[model samples]
Target: MAEDGRERLGIVAGGGGLPMIVANAAIEKGMEPVFARFSDGMTNDSIIGRSRAFAWGRTGDAIEWLKAEGVQKLVFCGTISSRPDFRSILPSFKTLKRLPRALRIVKGGDDRLLRNLSRYLESEGFDLLPVQAVAPELLAPEGVLTARTPTAEESAALDLAHRAATALGVLDAGQAVIASNERIIAMEGIEGTRAMMRRVAEYRAARKIGRGERLALVKAVKPGQDRRFDLPSIGVQTIDEAEAAGITAIGVSAGESLILGFDDVIDRANTAGLAVCGLGGEQGTAR
Candidate 1:
């Protein structure tokens, strides 16, 4: 438990409900949470009640505010889909020193970038904590969670999709795949899982698919991905998207992926006749 005066959790939130979940979990643990989100990343209505707003290039100011608030621990959550406008990123004298390194950071791939940012944050005296540090229950558990279970065919397809997704993770490409009858149908790209599922939905609508075969929506954690930032996370919307895409089963990396709104997600999946299962694997990559 944190002390009354000198301890607080600074939540650097992004787009999604996961940040709210994390904040609530921290609050339950007796830590005051300062919910801060980027100006462009607060697309979720859940962040509306109480929050601290910060601009993209104002890390120096944000850090000072958190320090003043006694927020010694920091947790980064949510999806930052928008690229920083370099023009707006003008650096002050204090932030000017970090700007060059930050610019170089953007040159690397996602994993490299996350690692660099984590290190930078630690160097600045803030303790970077994993999301699970505050919310262990958010981690997806092993085995099926819904009333429906994957059929024998969908089981095999899940295996195939998991393998393909892992291979793709090796290239830092994507974390999710859609498969049927042991054949890969679609893979998540930069457009993300929802968009990929929508594509599958369009295909199903156009061709009248699902010939008694289950569509498997498989999501895996990226191989060697920094858990502090991009651990694979799913919410209730994922279930609705999968069901709309004709997905009969959903498999995520057990113990590694974050299952936001787990109970509600499972309840909706069961009601929609979709199976939500967790698959085990190593290095956060589901097998």
Candidate 2:
């Protein structure tokens, strides 16, 4: 229990470093942190040492555990790689009874599932907090994040791709769009940004050896999205993927996209001669 009379903060960690970051942030803020994490997805098991943690299969059980620990507020973090196989989600009878409504609300996307999950947790007496509220520093800063500036041709491509990505986002499609030489290479679907980047790389690699012209990757939040869940995120891994794929520039919404491992990502981008920029209010090219 916290001195402020608030119950301990409970975290549902899915995968990657994001969950660990959230847990650490909560502790720094003087809140007791408890985590319910998926077994094979979390990046570091050490996170369990920092807070109370349990595996995914026992989520319903974990909720009870949090209540026992006096946790009243909950935050969910990390990516649960979308799966077609539904067998993995062994919902308890409590959750199972609401499966139909959950399915109706989710409609097969990360954002929808999280929204439904948040609603369910709130109904169970746990107040769900926005993941960003834990660590607002993870949000990307405005302006360029690389040493190299975009070329005039690259700028044109970026503008086109940004608009396309923003439009797709509005439609509840994925957040990333890859474009090169004025042609759209790929639009992110359920496969995610990394998968989309790999596909673009494969296509580009098949065409030529070293043309030097690189694809532009743009990611942004949907026009009217709830900020709590499914906020756009990029990290060191994202930069590595773009650099490996010979992408010249990456654009992300300034306040909307969370830049995990910010310093390392910038260092990698600079070393690779990749231009990383945060889009401000107006959608325009950043060099």
Candidate 3:
């Protein structure tokens, strides 16, 4: 707690355990976390126990709630589905007027929207903190995660996929992309990574025979992305889905992407004989 009353931390939570993780981390740091959640696209009630939780509709209402709670700092975390249908935002009059302009500026993707939102919040006197500022351990470490390193061909495929995915991210498109044999099999769009991978697997199955070999999945962050929200994240479930989809290698940004389950995810990748690498720069050599 700081001199300004109780030091309150604001969390704009979406779906998944990431929000809970952020709340717990804040608690450990001795700051009170106040969660502002959306009714349709947020975590379960269990998160309430970890922090001061409130349900809000419009973005204006959310900001008001945070201001009312005396939150001086803000953190945005978790999986907010990229698809428009998954979001049930009820912007207030002020937010509604600014919404279109912000959407047009950022193209309405997770990273862009959140960055603009952070700027808006800052203009209103709230300081938005980096998501990693509270959960540093979530950042993916540089190295080969699995026991087996990527083969030469798989490494090449990963390199290509990484560049493509990063470019897509810059366009506010998506975070993950699937590539094999120097061809883009699938690019993540409004649907999440798992859905894209599942679609790619279905397509491969339809092709039959020689086409079913292991594919490379690359997840990267946009070069200038704001780290407060929609940072690329993977976990044990991500590894399980990759293995089930017959993915051979998973490449993520060395320091930018987050690995939620960290050890468990790496263990599963190693057990499944899959290659996981945190890649950086133009060079794609396995770490």
Which numbered prediction scores highest in TM-score against the true structure?
1
Q: What is the TM-score of each candidate against the true structure?
A: 0.91, 0.87, 0.86
Candidate 1, residues 197-261, lDDT tens digits: the string is 99999988888566565788888888878888778888999988888888888899998889998
Candidate 3 accuracy as TM-score: 0.86
lDDT of each: 0.80, 0.75, 0.76
Tens-digit lDDT string for candidate 2 (1-287): 85566447878776678887887788788777777666554545767643545433344566677777788888877776744234566667644665566555556455666676677778889887787788988887888877877777777778778888888977878888988756787898888888888887787779742476658888888776667777788888998898777788888888888998888989988888888888775856665
C-alpha lDDT of residue 226 in model 1: 84
Model 3 CA deviation exceeding 4 Å by range: 1-6, 50-57, 82-109, 208-212, 285-287
All-Cα superposition RMSD per candidate: 2.7, 2.9, 3.3
Residue 248, candidate 2: C-alpha displacement in angstroms: 1.0
How well is each residue in 76-95 modelled by candidate 3, as lDDT tens digits?
A: 87776533331455555755
lDDT score, candidate 3, position 126: 88
Predicted model with the maximum lDDT: 1
